[model samples]
Target: MTYQNYSLKQLQQIDAAHYLHPFTDHKELRDIGSRMITRAEGPFIYDSEGTELLDGMAGLWCVNVGYGRTELAEAAYEQMKELPYYNSFFKCSTPTPVLLSKKLAELAPKNINQVFYGSSGSESNDTALRLVRHYWAIEGKPEKNRIISRKMAYHGSTVAGTSLGGMDGMHQQLGGAVPNIVHVMMPYAYELALPGESDHDFGLRAAKSVEDAILEAGAENVAAFIGEPIMGAGGVKIPPASYWPEVQRICRKYDVLLMLDEVITGYGRTGEWFAAQTFGIEADTITTAKALTSGYQPLSALLVGDRIAATLVDKGGEFYHGYTYSGHPVACAVALKNLEIIEREGLVERVKTDTGPYFAQMLKRISGHGLVGEVRSVGLMGAIEIVKDKATKERFSPVGSAAVAIRDHAIANGMMMRATGDSMILSPPLIWTRATIDMAGDRILKALDLAERDLRNA
Candidate 1:
């Protein structure tokens, strides 16, 4: 029986009874009920009640090519009919994965030419962690396995990914985390910068924290430092211009491998194939997913640099790590088609030259609102910091509550944005045009005004 036969109430009841959603509070969800998204097209999603919402978060930071992409659907259908379920195990190979690998290699940075497949960013990050440690062990340094990450930086939700990540809330839920993963200060100058500190100076200082960790742990004990190029789930925290170059220098100085988790920033999100290229980072490994298939299918690729790939090739030995759907043919096919659409439509270039700059300028119109402390963006990803006092930059009493109010207001006003603590974030589809940007800006400003009024009354 398809869900289309059921009423919205019936569907909600069924979902509450059987479905356990990720990162959700079940009891709270049951109280509120789910807003059933029946369908989506372009950059908007429609509820079962037929309310249209301009998706500002791109369906949880994916869906780059927008919705209703028949090309992706057709590609998946064709691949499924031809070779639906084949495992890349026991010396078996598929044409789609092989072709996708070549395409990804051509698109990725020059150093990253090899790929390891997984179903999601979390799984690929697990692969990256294991692969880097395995590389160090094979090179006759078994003890060099500690990884340094940034506090509040999100990697994923798996045990290793959560441990590599530095979210205190996630760590609290985790009974215990993987050992030897240390976290340092992030390069978020808005909150962390000292009074009168320059962005460049703060960036260097943040990079220095990585060096300090290596020194404290002994460089020989540190294998790699993994981080998101732009901390997406951690409030779209884009580092300063000087951050990545300094971090790269530090990693090179201590012979530490630089791992980039580009789950949210990959594809056309950053006006480039990968955030590593957007930021000029020379990463040893890049864990990518999300927009790889524009959320049409689940697929992840861990792009390995030449050095690591060469080491694995030269010092050949089974690393003993893989998933059942490592290189799923259908997912790869959808991804290939998604990449084609991104390229065919010139979405990346559009984001780079036309929409990105316009979006930033549009966001500035709302920056002067009393409730917005700061507005920051890179490419299509953006953040608006909610503040209680404009001059003092004081946040609301409960940290995230203000952003929730604003997000609710935004959704009520027919736009979808995300709330991370006190920051309202946006990662709209690459297909959004100047008109879409204007609409979003107006909706956001209205939401901000509503939030400010409500907060003042409260």
Candidate 2:
């Protein structure tokens, strides 16, 4: 009776009058209207107008198991009916979160054996910042509280998350960031690699920046070095293969804790349970959310390593930080069922063996396009860089305009995607088949052709 009773126009009118969206321009949005997504199933979403588009961004880089999972819904319903809401505080506990935490610990890296719950990636990152600092303080190094992040990294949007991240726009609007969180260069070989530099060499150089930051901070002051394993919101900037191991080695050398922000890359997104496993990274903390329950529920788990967990337990002081919904029973029930669904369907195995490789091969269809500067992909996530000059990899003036045009054209052609800077990003659901890949590629090629014509005309 909700959307059924309200007309699309009426909903849009009400939305414009009352709603506020994140990372949106309100004035510009008021000029237009919100595109109401009425329903979704498999890998497609239907708008209020009944136009269906293949979802290529996986509902903001979550929804790993895709949409319309009845098992997850039923799990939530059963949990709610049995135990609607309860706080994991005051010496109380819940069975669902307790069981979910054990499942997560089994899935996480061996050293990361404990779980801390929150409601979103932002909250988990906040917890991560607090946890690492707390760990150092417990170990009697309160001054070792500095965090090293990468430029263009997307941690989350909370004040602590924003400060831990290194986006220029977010920082400008942030007014001020948390202190001692230094930013280093990202290991993006496409732009950062020098002429005649091998990918392996470029990776080492990028990893060296962490060492430099540690040395500058005297190692005694730096607490942890945080980064997304695949840099998802940073245009899926996949680093060179040699980057992570070397960063891990440097962190070990400097005793700087490694924090992996896998909010977008966790829960089989990168063809593994976690991208830390994908790259053999031994991070002290892994911040995960988004696809944890395939977007069926809001939940985040900060996987803490043994070293930190043991110290905190031995210190025996209350952490003095936790959310009211830290371990909500309903969300935990949904997540357990969601993980079961992922495992039962062998979705991760499919991505690792079949779909992921096919996606890499299929993306070649647009690799040679006139407007495409370079194409890159890992697993199901991909990026197509739009450029004015192919030889020089020079982008068009008014940055992001061409990619935005391509994105719009792609959506109009029934292929949903996102544009970040001058690159078109695609992180489709894990359940996509070869046929879905072909369909998405065809629509994107059409979009590229249309955008090329418009750009050349201008």
TM-scores for all candidates: the values are 0.99, 0.99
The true-versus-predicted C-alpha distance at residue 100 of model 2, in Å, is 0.3
Local accuracy of candidate 2 as per-residue lDDT tens digits, 1-458: 67879998999999999999999999999898899999999999999999999999999888888899888889999999999899998989999999999999999999988999999999999999999999999899999999999999999999999998889999999999988899999999888999999999999999999999999989999999999999888898999999999999999998999999999999988888999988999999999998999988999999999999999888789898999999899999999999998899999889999999899988887898899888898788899988999999989879999999999999999999999998899999999999999999999999999999999899
Instruction: Give a tens-digit lDDT track for model 1, residues 89-189.
Output: 99999999999999999999999899999999999999999999999999999999999999998989999999999999899999899999999999899
Q: Give candidate 1's TM-score.
A: 0.99
Clashing pairs in 2: none
Q: 135, model 2: CA deviation in Å?
A: 0.4
The worst-scoring run of ten residues by lDDT in candidate 2 lies at 1-10
Residue pairs with backbone overlap in model 1: none
Q: What is the lDDT of residue 267 in candidate 1?
A: 95
Clashes of each: 0, 0
